[model samples]
Target chain A: MKYRFNTSTMSEWKIAVLFLGYVLATILAPTTAAENILNEESARSASEQQKLGAYLTRAGNCMGCHTAQGGQPFAGGRRLSTSFGIFVTPNITPDKEAGIGSWSEEDFWQALHQGKSRDGRLLYPAFPYTEYTKVTRQDANAIFAYLQSLPAVSQINPPSDIRFPYNFRPLLSIWRALYFKQGIYTPDQSKSAEWNRGAYLVQGLGHCNACHTNRNLLGASEEDTLTGGRIMGVNWYAPSLISRLEVSSGDWTIEEITELLATGISKRAVASGPMATIIRQSLQHLSIEDIRAMAVYLKSIAENNNDDTSGTLVPVISENMKEQFAQGRKLYDTYCQECHGVSGEGVAGIYPPLAGNRSVIMASPLNTIRTVLNGGFPATTAANPRPYGMPPFQQILRDGEIALVVSFIRNAWGNSGSWVTALEVDRSKSGER
Target chain B: MMHFILLITFLLITPVANAAKSVPDTIAERVKACTICHDNEDKIERHAYYPRIAGKPQDYLFNQLRHFRDGRRHYQPMAILLENMSDKYMLEIAGYFSTLPLSFPPPEQVSIQPDEIKLAKQLIHSGYPARDIPACSACHGDTLMGIAPSIPGLLGLSRAYITAQFGSWRNGGSMRGQVSTCMSEIAKKLTDDEVNAVTKWLAAQPVSTQPGSISVLSPALTNRCSNIVLGEHTK
Candidate 1:
């Protein structure tokens, strides 16, 4: 028998074994490929439930919507307004039938991903699943697990009052097909792994573009617009995040940028309004890597570094600004000196030198005028306080005179800015006393 | 001339005193202790540690003054000055203080930790590329100080506040969590080492004196580290 064995036989045997290995691998890979799969029995455990709870906290945007009117801290019920319709919030207290007492993890993930009710009906976009679609299957399952663990609420969500075309639920499939790109983010290999990871989290899981970037009529993102956009109802413009530098000028450094994300107060900016809510809650609590990913993605964007000088087409100024430098020079000499100093250095730290203040010479002249009109006080903290401030000239000078003093401010102390015209003063439309 | 006079008349009668109303009637009566260190023309000394605060927001000033009065704030004569004052007087002092101007300081040699600079740049320009975090400048402004009064400035602040607050937020020490909770989410995500690095970078950067012209921030903030240059996609 050994004499009968040939070289060809051995080669054939090797090939057969190779084929068998490939077959086994193909069969096993799919089952493993599916991410976030959980055994029903194992998921019922408590530790898993808590982990799922964290996932839900991120996915449900639970805190953002559940918050009550007066900072009652996620007590539920904030009005959600949309172009398609208005959805009154339904309380999700842990009551028996009203909430998800009867819901299974299968049911919850379906509700989120498919936008279907437990009974199998479509949900509206007011729930923000358009952004939530990127959550992985396992994540969705975990979130479901967490929600099921919560005490079921008896509060039934009031039906959304969507007008006309929005009232139809089946129409969503087409919209989803057109606008929703569903699937887990595959890391792009060409870029740095971290950059790719950032892209995934931001474009996929985090869906930062939903708020930070601009959107078109169908709510589709305007591809060209990155971080600059207009947030409706909030009465604010979410400024551009393109430049690696600070767009608002206070010369913010990178560390300050990170601190702002984590603590809401950087040297140049303080978190307030809606963004404050986000910092105090969702974004600030993310894992460190996630924050880093976001920072990388944002900084990567190219900024419109050139100054937008269009706002000054009509350089509005005041009569007082014109007159003060021309006439009030004596007034300035008398009262302003001892404090402001002859050189306009104005006791550094005690008093901010007026020569180069942003409120004085930035492209947007509104702040400088308003600060003078309204008068301002700098914030002090555990770090430093007892800061210096400026006097309001709103009363002593005429608009022209105010204009002159402002002109002096714009011109003097090494300050070189567009001249303050009387037109600028009249344009302020002040809310000051 | 008649229109000019009319505008002046309206302004004079517009009750300008109300604008700086938070200030006391007399400088002697408000922030008398502040002058002790701040009044010096040197632009250095004890005042040097403190950033210039003139023309800052009234709300910002008021908040700090209250912090001083309540002993929530640390640092110099401010706490001592605010110690015995009533909230009203404290607010007045804040108002009075806020009216002053900021001047360019003589440059200080800042110490930059190599790792801190690396992490700070990573966090600022792009977040941890591997994680899903967004850049801090996304909403905070690229410079980290915001735009206008609407956006705050980061140029002249103490780095200690920047670092401490970040740590507190990461562990959930803020005024409780809210949806717009920017810092906490980001902080909680940062590694302890990364946090230290960011703090070092922030503290190391030179503070700019030019008020509105933050044109220099871009160059100063972009940290060039070797690991980041590898260009591998974040997994």
Candidate 2:
């Protein structure tokens, strides 16, 4: 009777314990699972914010100006030479002592929207705050978060070396009053959302007019126009975005314009020098839709400003220039014909065709002069990696020869650019604007 | 041409007077001190320690100047001299030196074991494939005159200079962080005795009648070296 009681009791005790454990687990699971879900949602939202901020930062090309050559990214000491004076960019890293780590999101928004520092100091126009003023508060907040997320770098920013009258910080107030306007971009209700998005990016974050428009002596832009101008300090010129005589994309397909913006090269054109830098650092990183939007906006502007008078003014070849023209053709055959072709038509896409290229026929001729003398690669991007290069002729060609060759190509193939003088070439050679 | 003759006449008329006071302000005048050590004299003894740089490829000369300027090469005097030079100025100096007509002394007669000569020839011509070594002629042309743009000729170099270069490459002194991995790798692979034999043989060889570097590179050898790009466009 005692043995039968021992086996039954053992089995019943084990079942009772197992059922109790299952009941406890069922009761406790929901609280922990709900807590996990809350944590995950917050984490994912923060990560999404960081990701968008990073993308916008590239779109703005903050690193291009903020980072000095061979210096840590965003720990800025870049010396930007302008007509006013040299403006050294400030550090934007998250170091507590040396950077903007102590800044609140509101303080950062004030800097972008109002061009005022946390301490109420007026920032220079060289920082391009005039363009940043149009950035949405939400986007500005995202950029701040992204910058804060960066590895903190302890680097002290150097004071800008602005010349006499321009160095006076109060003078910037008058300049800002005359030139700058602080406002967020308002979408045009009449236009398509795509067009409105393009306008916001180009006018706000893209800052296309900062380089494309001519600046007055006070360093103020003419207007929110994409007409061409010479970039201060750098002898290279930024060609017009609207004029067909310079870099109009009016006739180009949207896909073609997008390809050029995204890849730095299209069948009809290639970006070199400053534009090349922009494509490499900023435009190349944007989504195809955003780039297409930019193209659409630029093309619309170009169409409105496009004049049929482009390429109609043929320069008369003077008696003195005839010999130069002959010499240039000979030189072109010997050196440039292999890649640029016998008729001055460059290999399509690989080597930009010189025949109808707007860059070659631009009025200033600085771009063509610089390109031949210095030689350059079109922007190296993911879509167009291993781009072809032009060998620098500075060593091989003299000032006269460069002038002649530049003049030859500009006039050859139905182009109407004026002949460049040897003196002009000489000036360019010495890097004197 | 007339101005050159006039300069010669002026020099001949007052040799001592012109020599002290009338050196023309030109790249040739600026680099006169370099020629004192890197002598290009035709009848000088062939055993000089300094390697002749005249008539080398322009890009090869330019790269050397940059290496010295950037402290990639260990030589202090060269680095000091080239420290402040710009790329445009360096190209000008390189062009001046590269355009000079080439002249060479007869190859020095070296006394070495026949077996050493055979090994050197094998290494230079065919290379030891077991060690994944490429032939010297792969990048440097079959004539050892180098392929144009950046490669340098092997012939007419002093034995001391060649030995020093090999040692430099082996120790990673000259090509510090440079992309030309083949030379350093080759230097590390070769035994000291093999390097000695190779240098002796190379130094004993006569300079080719056709001077400077050849522009054409063999398609097979283009990818063997890291720095050189095949079919690179140039003037």
Candidate 3:
């Protein structure tokens, strides 16, 4: 620049330097400001994302099955009893050696979406990845971030005590091939947003089908997810959600379903057994909107025509049957009339009504017989802190006597359900016990 | 026309008489109605929350019935059942239950920790002077078998029932009474831990061989409980 004293050359060089400086400043200044903004935005969103993830985790009730009694939360050692064998839950904490700490977001996503580990190892269905597979990658990443934020607990999970053929990890791949489908939920265009959200939660994070859907011998859920099934090895029936004659029947209002899920008690039913646990741990914590969404979805499930009782012939009460009814009536008067009411119209807020109660009159009389014989207490929850209980008649009533009482409840007070035979009662009682 | 009228009257009167006859008359038969929730007389400990009323003091039982009827207590079923009953009939029922022989099964084997037992023993015998909580034995008698006519024995009741009663008292369930109940006053002074310990220990205790009401009052009760009355006939 000093050598070129000529006016034109000097002006050109000055212009070139000015342009270069302008380019450098223009490129550097906004990037630095943008970096600061990006940092602040990310920091803010990260926490919000974590909060959402925490909510989702609660909705999924991950800690319920993962955390063992007296063990660190999420540092799993709980033994889940199944018909196949006892499966020990693994540590989900962020420990590098014992948990998923070493895993990348992709690895975690693979675990949930494909039921596979970072090393391409197949995961057991007990992890509930089949349902988790419907989870979006963004949501999976958020969950991973939340898990990573937790304190790393180095708890080595006990090895599962599964039987030989089932314990083989390679077999899980074959099982996945048959049963597992890797896909995110595609919202139905025709349904409302609430319904779609409910479907997503029910089919994915809530994993209602894990207990509610009937499973085949191979442990794959049968075609219909809402049709209901027996809980394996537990001898408790998770009644059909779709059937008009079963749980959440056609007569139930959406509000009743919401109330039952939120408070563990409703006009029509109370949450007992496993359902109580689900309400306490999972459903009660959800937002009212989410609960309403679930109710909407549950209500929209079409009533199965097969459940219609119109085609079936009501049995004629023979003289012997009349005698049995009389005997059952006497037993009811002596034991049940005070709380259940003379007409089976139970006292509001104190006792559940037996008159036209779906639980009492469902096609499967397993729960009723078991409830009468063993007596079940309603699940104590925040909403229903002082729930009324039914005392066990196992010690007081014989099998035949239990059968009579159960049959009486089923057939009494304008209810028209199939008769519960003594043999059925005996079988259910023994099986449950 | 007169004969037809007489026949119609007879038909109506006969059905009414039959209905009256079907109603439980004897105290034993009437008490059988209670076994729907309460256990049978012989096996009174079978139900968890239902108290054994078979051998409770006559005055105590009468007062409870009165309280239920008068809305001083709040059990819907009890209130409804006792609503129309005459005071004399309730007293008769109470008298019948009181005279019946008291029988209790062996104390239930509840798994209470040593620390809990220690806390229970402290509260039961010494009382919490710092919190102004009097010893349970002060009013319940040194044997905890209860004093004459009105005080109820704590030994034969279930832990759940005892706890619930204490909880009710603490929650102002006895506020309906014109005078503060002794239970309400005592329950208010106790911490939740103390309540739990006391109930658990009391439920696990073996009822004394002489489980019947005593003639004398507990010596520690310098002040009489206004809510309790020995009823002229019971005395």
lDDT by residue for model 1 (A253-324), tens: 445555655554443344333454455445566655655655665556545345654334654447755555
Clashing pairs in 3: none
The candidate, 1 or 2, that scores higher on lDDT is 2
Question: Model 3, B173: alpha-carbon shift in Å?
Answer: 40
Order of candidate numbers by TM-score, starting with the best: 2, 3, 1
What TM-score does chain A reach in every model? 0.60, 0.90, 0.85
Candidate 1 off by > 4 Å: A1-49, A55-61, A70-75, A90-96, A114-122, A168-174, A223-225, A243-254, A302-433, B1-235
Please give the DockQ score of every candidate, comma-separated. 0.02, 0.02, 0.03
What does candidate 1's lDDT look like per residue over B71-96, in tens digits?
33433234333332335546565566
lDDT measured at residue A349 in model 1 versus the true structure, 0 to 100: 31
